[model samples]
Target chain A: MSTTSTTAPSRTSRTSRPRRRLARFGSTGFIAALPFLAPALVAYLVFVVAPALESVRLSFFEWSGFQGAPQVFVGLQNYVRIFTHDPVFWTALSNTVIWVILSLVIPVGLGLVMALALNRKIFGRNLFRSVFYIPGVLAPIAIANMWRWMYNPNYGIGVNLAQLFNLPWLADVQWLGDKNLALYSIFAAFVWQIAGTNMVLFLAGLQGVSPDHVEAAKLDGANRWQVFRNVVMPSLRPTTVVVVVLTIINSIKVFDLIVGMTGGGPAQQTQVLALWSFQQSFNNHEYGSGNAIATVLLVITLIIVVPYMVWTAKQEKNS
Target chain B: MTVTAIPTAAAPVANPSPKRKPRPLSRGRDWVRVGLWVALLFSVLIWAVPLIFMVFTSLKSEADIFGTPAFVPPWAPEWGNYVEALDRGHLLTAGGNSLIVAIIKVPVGLFISAAAAFALSRIRFKRQRLLMGVIALGAMVPIQVAIAPLFQVINGLNLLSTNLGLILPYIAFGLPYQTFILYGFFRQIPEEIDESARIDGAGNWRLFLTIILPLAKPALAALFILDFVATWNEYSIALALLQSQDSWTIPLALQGFQSQFTSSYGPLNAFTIMSVFPVLIVYLMFQRYFVEGAFAGAVKG
Candidate 1:
């Protein structure tokens, strides 16, 4: 085996050296990588990349998704209609913005508070951590369903508790049914479902904080809040960036909960970009218009996500 | 590497010095600790209420579900709700479908993504960074953006509503994050190992399979759990693609069951509990790896 191994390289070197040199443009390394990458690349291209590009292409055309139907090129008309003519589009966009802001603040804020509270050597820290994180692990559909039932006007906890407490005004309030309250109610559910994830992430970040720095700050007369603000927060910059970016992306892609809980109901009050895109394309059969909304959503998401991705890649490379 | 380093730095703070006597100020701190405990307990109870309600409602008969307070335990637990969910709600079949999808998709997707990640991390090629960036960006591409064209593509291939259809996209969409994580892992492995293997007349394929793959078992396991949970809980693609009842996953089936049994909270809650139980078990079993993998993917990617 040793002899064959020894001779194999010499023989190949002598005969194949020139060819290998010539194959630099398509080296053995690159060639070998093809089989490794082909399956994922082909699938990603066909299912992800091509479809993304097709969505962009379809945005400029009017088509009902009928097989063999001609796609009429309408040259920005879809965009124009979405921007100027559609009231629902504005509501969805504004709601999406609200979602983005709420997801940014509430989950991040609560997660930070929980992380801080749980950071020290506390009793049942592990139990609390696990319990808090359970919601995040469950399916969003399940969470939404649970909350939907909780928000049920007739048999819901909200109404029943309100009635038990003799708060008639609170008892009669429609949580998911009212246009003004549906989106915020769903946002609250979203926060409950996701805050655990943020907590866990922040805990991980907290673990990385230099305890010595915190101790030093304390020794220098820094109070609890000051120590946290001065020592812990700066060290958690990386985690904070990650949490914020992920929350934004998750907020923008909010669909499952809306679909499960509200279905963008009460005059499309809860309609976000994603749900609206789905409704327009699949439900309304306005393929072009739907694709346009999807394209807008894509652009908006890319605008935020791409830069962060680039930043992450660069950070990883540097480290 | 860095993950290990961070914990070591924090370890000393966890254990106070035994030589130091307890001070009077420590009594004050005890009250603060109590406050913290109270706050944590309150949060835990609040966090658990919805799930507790789910279990309570699932255990009750239809009459009790509406009759009793949401928090009250059932006098006689309706174990038949689970049976009804399985039989009437088609949850077992949907669960089987979910299992099949996850079982097939997770490992297959991991292998494919690991392979691609191996290429990106180990192989010297032009356009490597650009390709990596593109794949990373793919992680952020919302499924809504691709659903329209992807649906059309699946229809064109006549794969829509089939498990294969769902599996394909799950694998595809799962690739970016899996590849990103695996690539980070692969980069951490020393290059000398690959060099020695190459010197021993091992090619790239053998080197990857024999050396690098084994070395990456932790990462593989982490991604395995993460990807499995994701695939199992995936909603949008399954909803859009798997239109037929037989092809529905747990989430899709749960949604359908809820819609069908709008008034019956017992079976609906039972179905909900059943669907989330496996994922919860997996998360609990691998809590360390799950949390680490989750944060690592986001923070280190």
Candidate 2:
């Protein structure tokens, strides 16, 4: 066996030099990549991976933040309370779903339409693209603050239009104050800011479709609607999937717009899971419950995100 | 790679004729096209109207903001709001904080993400594929979800309220996405170069730095700019970590200002306008790169 192992290399290359070279190559790669690999591994493990696991551990504890020596482990009590006992938790989660659906449905729908329009060799296409995409490029703080005024109820256009048209906006029915309208209003601001991103993605997807197919469809007497439905939609599936995933993730994580516009208020109508998590951790100092909520979100995210990622990777492998 | 086929028809006609008579607007395509342009222009106007209102409100007096029916402010606009918002120190300090965070974050984030992406993409190992999948899934985890435990870790490390502390967490949260994008770009690079580099006695570090990094400049630039913008505008983590007024970044300061100026629309609007310009300038300056980068980092992958 030893003789055969030694002779295998000699049979192929007739020398020990290439074996040494291969060994050197392998070692060199390992050594060279260590610097790059170590920092990322350490930082991510220390800050991300460890904390995530620790959060799951902490979710079982009852503790106040920064004022205690240690926390008491309560074992599923935190999760139990969040699910059954807490009104705010359910409200926050429902609001998140509401925001996600509204924001995703509108922005993605409009984006696909816009992408179809802009994908053509239309005049002033750049101008139109820029106008739509500007909101995306601007800082979130800027978009949020600007929209706060735009929704200002009195001097703002929304309120002004309602009043001028003899419909009371801020006076009779508070858009930001009403529970039903507040979440929807927040969703509107979010859609306005992020629609451009989806549009850009869809535009990229639309451009990926060859013009010949489109022209051929036209020659076959396929109407614009038919061509779009049959030819355009199927080709754009991956992009749609990506857009959907990103929109869902973005919707789930939305915080700045809610904080800037509503502060989760008139009476917790617009409170989302993210803001709720933050409020629990920082405002209420209930670190355990907060961490519990965070852990739940992480698990939920995995349930959605993992399958999609694996599916994409599998698609890539197959392709 | 979908192939298209040409339809066979008559080779030539005695007199080539243009086909029309399907739709009324087909005869005057120019006018219909013009109408489409007008409709597009109107939709754009709808998008811009709110921005214009914000600008006008910023320039108007508090009283004028309500009283004036004038879409365009009458006479010389009141620019006092800009002065007042600045004097309040919210915009100035917060802008400075955001700038500091962004500047530090860009290089740090780029190096880490690039290195990690390089290893993940190029290194063939048993665990590489699994690690890549993990990080991609990590990208989808909400930052808010991580906030609680992160606060626990940060407070334990005594990093609360310090810029470094805030910056550390931001970098951590940003890595999964940044690395995911960069990994895709890195993988697209041909393997021949790395083989050739190894043959030339170039070490992996030397090869990565000299060959791969130079080739990955566009991807790196795109990642750097995105990290900058995201870190710049980030609020939730910053809000939670930064409790002190002085340590506050622009988004937090804007939140603080929002409460203070809840009654006065002028200064609030002015501050909002002012707050956006730094980010605007960055975006415009790298507008070409931003557009191309969006496609490269996003579309292909």
Candidate 3:
């Protein structure tokens, strides 16, 4: 080899070696990140991390909020009250499960169907998709408020529709009153509000599916149902999983919909975990019990999310 | 494999290529497909009914809304309902508050999240990975649970009943997700550019401002819109932080309007329509970017 070429490799190796090795250890590039990370670190510590730690600490102390310093440290008494004593806690838990299941099923299933339909060469594809997704883009408070008006019995659509058919809609039977029907009524509103965005997500996933594979399936004499089962459904499974997980998580955190629609009303029948925690901590002035509920909610959310995250991470590695 | 053996099947379509003859559609099969579409359309209408009802109620007079013939208003259409709603509710003031927050929040949040994401992407540090993990985990926790202590923390800082108070939490709540997104984008840009810049003696800030920021403009714009929409529409925090009427955001004020005027659906509906207009306009303007940003970090391999 020429001396010049030989010298080039030696210099190249020397210069690139540190950068490559640093990338491997992921440690070489530190200075560039400092300015950006500093502010975020401070804010996270103060606003997010501190509050989370305080919640754990506050769960043990019995207090009526800022009224006075916590009178006593009950130590697990607050937690025990939830599992053993509080019927409301159990109701909220059950309501949470119901809400999660409903949210997961309706939004994902409807979203899939909507995506498939909208994916066709429809004349007004953009218009239709945009209209369906309007609810999701509108702020949550606005959508919830709109739904609240629609559910109003007097001069509201529900009343007018019921009167058109001569049925007692909101007056005789409490849409918000009956314990059995109350949760479902609130759920109906949620499904409407979320189905749009979920549909958009599913559409993106469907579009990502390779058209060649779909064409191959069609050429193989697969019927509509057979094609859907063997090709489209499997192709869409990952998107479905994403949708389901997000839906379930959002359901657990549901507050605005219930607050706007019913305020967990007619009785405590409609109260989910988020609203329950807010009521206990803020409204009822029971800080310890409220924190206890929040802690359990946090744990439960982790229980669902942590495993799924680990599983997905492993799946990503294997794939 | 037998068709039945394949439990998960994709819908099959007949080939429409000119080289291949199109398969005949049996009458029965065609009828079944049409029937399904009809059923689906009706289901969609059922879903749309509540929204349609809201629009209709807003047009009717109070007497028409109350009278025996509830379907038919006693008089003609009422544009006055909107005027009355504007007068009754502090709709304009509440809207102004929402606009101010969204306007302020977008740039601040984009700066914070984008800056953090840029650092995490460009620089290598062990602490960076750990910090990223902490943020990911925090995203799973519900914000509602954090409200009580968050309020306490804000109050301790003496920001209560101020726009700064609400703005602080809004930015904090939005940071993680926005960071997650921008970081993903920043990392995608090849490191060759950075190395070339270093060779030319571009300092860190100059490289970022000149080379990196311009390239990352699309991602920043996307984050701005997403943060704006989230902040503008946010309620639970607004309700908690801003106790006074002057500080109430649009959503909070709208809720207050509903309770105050139990009999008047016109103004309430009118208020709903007005409040949603600005959001809809923004959405329409930057819609392509909004959809792209939303699904960007979400579809991680």
The candidate maximizing lDDT is 1
Question: Which digits, one per residue and each the tens of the lDDT, describe model 2 over residues A167-266?
Answer: 7644455667677788887677777788877887787677567789989999999987999898989999878888899989998888888888888887
What is the C-alpha interface RMSD of model 2? Answer: 3.5
Q: Of 1 and 2, which scores higher on DockQ?
A: 1
- The per-model DockQ list reads 0.50, 0.41, 0.40
Question: Which stretches of model 1 miss by more than 4 angstroms?
Answer: A1-29, A313-319, B1-21, B291-299
Under CAPRI classification, how is model 2 graded?
Answer: acceptable
Q: How does candidate 2 score on lDDT?
A: 0.76
**lDDT by residue (tens digit), candidate 1, B1-301:** 4346234433534676656866887888878889889978998998888878888888999888777777778879999989988887878788899999899999999999989999998777778878988987888878899899899999989998898999999999989978987888888887667666766777678888999998887678667876788888899888889878988899999999999989888888888988898998898786754443243443354
Candidate 1's docking class is medium
Chain B TM-score, one value per candidate, order as shown? 0.90, 0.88, 0.82
Candidate 3 residue lDDT tens string, B1-301: 1111122212223325536533576667656656766765666677667666666667777766566344453357788888988898998888888888888877887788777876776766667755775776666788877887887898889987788888877878777777766776677777778777766776666667788878876567656665677787888888878888988998889888978886677778787887778878988985543332243223232
Candidates' TM-scores? 0.91, 0.89, 0.87
Ten-residue region with minimum lDDT total, candidate 2 chain A: A14-23
Candidate order by DockQ, highest to lowest? 1, 2, 3
Which should have the higher lDDT, number 1 or number 3?
Answer: 1
Query: lDDT tens string, model 3, A34-150?
Result: 777777767777887788778878889888887446558999999998889998898898999888887877877887788777766433445556666767767666677777666
lDDT values for all models: 0.84, 0.76, 0.74
Q: With candidate 3 superimposed using the best TM-score fit, by how many Å does residue B285's alpha carbon deviate from the native?
A: 2.7
